[model samples]
Target: MAEPITLTAPNNTSYSQPTGLFINNEFVAAKSGETIETVNPFDESLIAKVAAAGSEDVDVAVAAARAAFKNPAWRGLSAADRGALLYKLSELCERDKHILATIDAWDNGKPYQVALDEDLAETAAVFKYYGGWADKIYGQIIETSDAKLAYTRHEPIAEQTPLSVLYLGTLIKEAGFPPGVVNIINGYGRTAGAALAEHLGVDKIAFTGSTTTGKAIMRAASVNLKNITLETGGKSPLIVFDDADLDQAVKWSYVGIMGGMGQVCTSTSRIYVQDTIYDKFLDRFKEYTVENTTSGSQFDEKTTHGPQISKTQQEKILGYVESAKSEGGRLLLGGKPGAEKGYFVEPTIFADTKNHMKAVREEIFGPFVVIQSFSSDEDAIEKANDTEYGLGAAVFSRDIVRAHKAAAAIEAGMVWVNSSQDSHFGIPFGGYKQSGIGRELGQYALSAYTQVKAVHAATCSGAHASPYRSGIISRNSSLDRGSILQAGDHVSPSKRPGAKA
Candidate 1:
């Protein structure tokens, strides 16, 4: 059995991080005595064993969240007040940015500096942006006849919502959803994840991870007829047109392929080059890959790429490289596992790949990119949207009209022009089709996290009477269905308390 691992700061660093589960407003141990070990991909060694929550812990977390929601302190509070709290949390996150970034680096094998600057900054921005939208929510009313007034009330659905806070502080306080409206319990997608999804109290579940895990989450969420928003795996496409800047395209494309060690959900794993610039793009891409292939520990200042999150992930990436070769995708550079004693797969680039190959279809969530050729705009769009997943896509072209046309044709939620992965906190981010449902980030994120309720104070006159007041039905009467609004349908006063007739 794995034991809880305690983390101590090196030298005089005062970073006493929380190792146990964070439930409700406090961190506590699991009700069940299970634990999960955090493996260091740098050395393929066990780093720490954290308290693992099972079904019992899930029940406790859900109950606490339920209590918080029902109480006047949380859910009953005004939207402005909730927004204030979220803003405060964002401020706190920003204050302790270094600590959280270090935690993310240790937990998820990304470079420490990148995690500190980019990941943590974006996480804080997401919360702060939604915090501003908390009080700005509103509803609408439709115009009706003089005798009738019809309005719609958008209301928040009250039910248990379990979320996975993957890779330590990556999504902590990042979600812009309503407070107490959605509950998040952090654990791996097996026991804690499965239990939360299958919990009868939960109404919706949102996940961001591998496709295999997404299928599991969907299956579990199905048990209770719960809605799901899954941001699963992606082998996103990056199209480089003949008119694109070769130097810029090659650099940015490689960044997308290996940024965060290429662990991003919408990482550009597939590259499509126009036949005119196909050879040029390949030459520059291969040159950059060869010149910039350096790997060590994530904390190393000189290291450009880091190891996979675990030994299993490393093995899976290596297996794909072998599979790609067998499936007829020619390896241009770095196709084998690294020699370092860690979960390191070399920054791989495969050329001569076809859209039909497994490398093109599957998401190799590592430092891997597959390049293929396209002859026309229609064919490029067809190949781009051919995957089962459509999270994010990018097209590199100087022609604005052609870029926009291609952007509209690609079936992904987010599309980039002349860039690969340029995400902003103010923009809505999520996938179309099987990639995910709804959107996250910006003011739009508040919509997914909340609902609207409308209140009207109209005069208590007979203005809301039946639409058809005439007793006789004319030749061209629109109110042919007289049974819907009869003048004296209520037989007695007791039967119809608010009847006008």
Candidate 2:
């Protein structure tokens, strides 16, 4: 078995960090006993070495999960019972929010305050929100003729291993979930992640990462034709109209690209301001950056800005800065390291940038943003929708009608009016085009883990050689005599589902 490593917080509080692969409700060493070093990004110092998973370890985890899926301890639970377990987990998360926030602050390089106030709060909310939906997982009953019954059932697509945080495993165990129902392993994406994606025993996969890696997972999952959901890369746009509240827009724009150190997939790295207030916006934005932002250790109470997740990430952001300079993008403010040590980068901005520039077209995934001016609403919409990514965009305007109009025109999966980056637990979150394949959060997320099954019971035999069995209705369902379908029913037009209307 692997042992837990202890660490002290800046506030002088101590906690044990579990340094093992959590499988079968226990923390155990990897098959090879290899370890991954967990570093504190605030100081670039060693924290502890956690057990690392290889392909062989993945096999063991998968086997355990398969057994648990069959075991009555997991399979026999009612939906409400399962939800109760999740609710207990949420309560545990709430109780330990401070410690969880501290772990993310040290390991992920986010400010402890924000992690506590925003990240941990949201984490607990997510679990509680989804837990509430467990008992409400309902299907529709179709209208069938007398002596006939037809309906559909939304069945669980997942029965085995669910992936999550190294800390979450402890929470799951504490919440009284069955062993192997949820497994977490620490390892690089190549070995353990790939093995899980390719495993035949796993029926589905939901991944949150870069578009490149999402594509790789899709390919590996092809071995079993596993159902997959990918939340991938983005270079989303945030537009500011001339009539917008200038201060609000400026402050939100800062939060847009600076939250999570701009590591968010839906970060609004591209901004379009109306030509009328372009210069003023930039001046105010620069002033706001100077006054409102701070860079330091995540443990420090004064710190607002934190370091990049790793040395590699810091270097990559720096490289993108150089690329911005070379591509004729004018630097407005902050284009270097914020401090002499750690993986800190200054909150950078590139103004007067062209749409074709790498700084605008690509997802830098750092605390960097490019600002541009638009002469007209048409121009703004066109510029915002020009990127291959359609993850998210924001529109700010005093006129709600105009704001909504512009929001509708933007070719993105989600759009915000008078706000940016802030999301609710009840909202569906995801992207379009290359940004992702499906949605998460709210009712949409429940669907991602569900499979629909249609049921047909013929109490009366020879009912016109069975309707809907041929996947086609020769006549209009409403016009047919004794048909149970009501008027205005949406009919499947043809056998070829992909055919355009």
Candidate 3:
């Protein structure tokens, strides 16, 4: 069994992090008894070790979920009651926001203040929004002929067996949810994630990760035809017109790519500026980026950027930078690794990048931005849409009509007007094409998490009358010999008339 490990943040706040899989509202060691070390990206120091779940752990978690779903304690709960529980969980998250933020900063290498103020706040708000929707998941009544009435119902899914996902399980238990209602197991994607994706008992899978892994999950889930919702990789573009506010465009472009060390899936990595103001925009953007962007420990209050999540990620970002330079991309500023110890990359920018450049085509998932100049609106749209990815995008223009028109034409899921990286809990978030499938956030997310079942009830006058009897009518008989018959009253079945069944 893996023992809880104590971690102390730069602020001297100490915590005993859980090192076990959370299942049936209890934290327990993985059946395999293996562990994976969790390290801090800022200093490359060991933070803690978490239990590494395997196929057996996934099975246990799925079985627990299946049993809980079958239990009336969970299945019999009213939608309002379930919603109350979610609300309670959101409240608990808000209460412990500071600790959560610290953990996120240590684990994910995002600025602590930003994690607290933005990411954690948004997470809580999302839960609260979904809570409000729990009781309002209504199904419509379909119009049909004969004495039949139909309606539908929605249901929940099973497990998420990742370290990040386990945090939700902890919150759910704190909110007083029933045992096994939500299970969390921690391990590598190849073992735990694949097992959960292929599990027959798991009715749905909501994944947010790389497109490569998302494809694997899709293939695995195809075996059971499990419902899948994927929010995958993005090589998004931020288009700035000649008439746009230069300062606003520069700031938003920075936020879109450099925010969270560019680990966001919807980061605007490719930037297109109008040729008329291209040079001016590039000079100002470089100045702003160099002057404002700071990289260091996430806990430092002055740090605007943090280290990459892992050594492997840092290497990947560096590789992309080298590839960009080799492919004729001019390095504008900061194209190398940061400090000696940690997994940090300097805020890198490449100019005069072509559409075919690796830095523009692939998802670096680091603080790297590629700038390209466009001659016209058509050129900008064509370049932006010239990727397999169709995730988030941005358009900046003073003309409202032109901006909206460009936004509509962009081949992406979400588009921001004169802004970037601004997301709301109420708005639907997802991507198009290879970026992802289905949607997350808003009421649309409920569709992915729940299934709809149609139910029909017969309302015939006679209790013992067969439901098929109404459809059977005499071929040669007429209700009124001299009267005209209604369209529905005519029978066309071979069993009743001179027609094929």
Candidate 4:
């Protein structure tokens, strides 16, 4: 058993924090005695020492998961029972929301309220939504010869990874999943994460992190031909048309780039305003941003914004601010450190930026955004699609037709009209281009965990010329269903359908 460390937040919230590598439904120490220091990003204080898993620990964890995959207790479980386990896990998460939120605020430098009210809530909803889909996963019938019955069967691909550190394991432990059904480990992405990606025992990998790391995992998984679903980097765009409700657009634009200190992967840091309203929109946007943003300790209720995840992140963001300045991007709002001690950064906006500049093209994961003006819809679409990333985008306009047109034209997996970053657990979430691979949430996420196999069996009375009709000259169906007459002279297929154009 792992020891629990007691912690007290600035707000007087006390909780027992777990710091272990969870495997086979139990918490254990790293084989190398390695530990990663969990730091409180709010004030650079040490939170606790969490066990650091390496290649050896990952190998052990994967072995356990592989064993569980073959275990009758798990493999023989009914689909509804699997879903029930997920539902119970979701409830466990909701029950411990405060503890989880406090951990997030302390470790991730996010506002406690946002972590508690939004992030934790959304996570619970996600598990519940997927739980509802456990029994609904099905494959369709394929058209083949009348002599053989053919269909597809889906099976669990591999291990169930932890959503994040600490609290998730507690929930899994409390949820009563069979031993080895889930595993959690804590270590640097370069070590433990790389091992999981490259481990031959792992059949599927679902990762969400930096684009560089995602690419590295892609390369690693190629060795085993594992199924990989990555939700990676984004320098997404949000366009504000001339006829849009300026106040609404300004509000959403602020939320798009400035929310979460712009650490979100889908943060719309690139804003293109129609030239007819560009100046006015900028004016209103600045006022709204300044009025709304207040960077301070994550535990402070009055603080609408929190610090970056670390001092390194803070310096990286500040460096980007300087790069924007050097590139001649107009600094429209706050551009300095947010607090004296904490890793806080004031929300900054740069106007008059060009598309070709690094300040405009790169994914600067910070509370900094750049603005540009476009003369027409064609110009807006062109500028928005300029980035190599295409995760998320949004369009704002009063004209419904124009809004939808721009939304469709923007090359992103998820596009919103007259809104920004609104996500639903029941809707698919992922990206296109270099942004990522497959979708994560909704029914589509099942594809990540399940593998399909086509099963065919012969039902013919006796041996025929061939099991498949290779002699058929026609590329279309040999005969139409519900009709006595054959559709084509090529009958070697014998009622079998052909490939469609």
lDDT, candidate 4, 326-436, per-residue tens: 988999887888678878788999999999888888888998899999999999999999989999999999999998998888899999888888988888899999999
lDDT of 4: 0.85
lDDT of 2 at 253: 97
lDDT: worst 10-residue window of model 3: 158-167
Worst 10 residues of 2 by lDDT: 157-166
Q: What's model 3's TM-score?
A: 0.91
Better of 2 and 4 by lDDT: 2
lDDT of 2 by residue, 62-124 (tens): 899999988999899988999999899999999988888887787778888998999889999
- Candidate 4 residue runs with Cα over 4 Å from true position: 158-164, 460-465, 470-501
The Cα local distance difference test for each model comes to 0.72, 0.86, 0.85, 0.85
Q: Model 4 compared with the native: what TM-score?
A: 0.91
TM-score of 1: 0.85
Worst 10 residues of 1 by lDDT: 158-167
Clashes of each: 1, 0, 0, 0
In candidate 4, residue 10 scores what lDDT? 80
lDDT tens digits by residue: candidate 1, 61-154 = 7776676667776667787987886787688778877767766666666777888889889877877887887787767765544434556565
Better of 1 and 3 by TM-score: 3
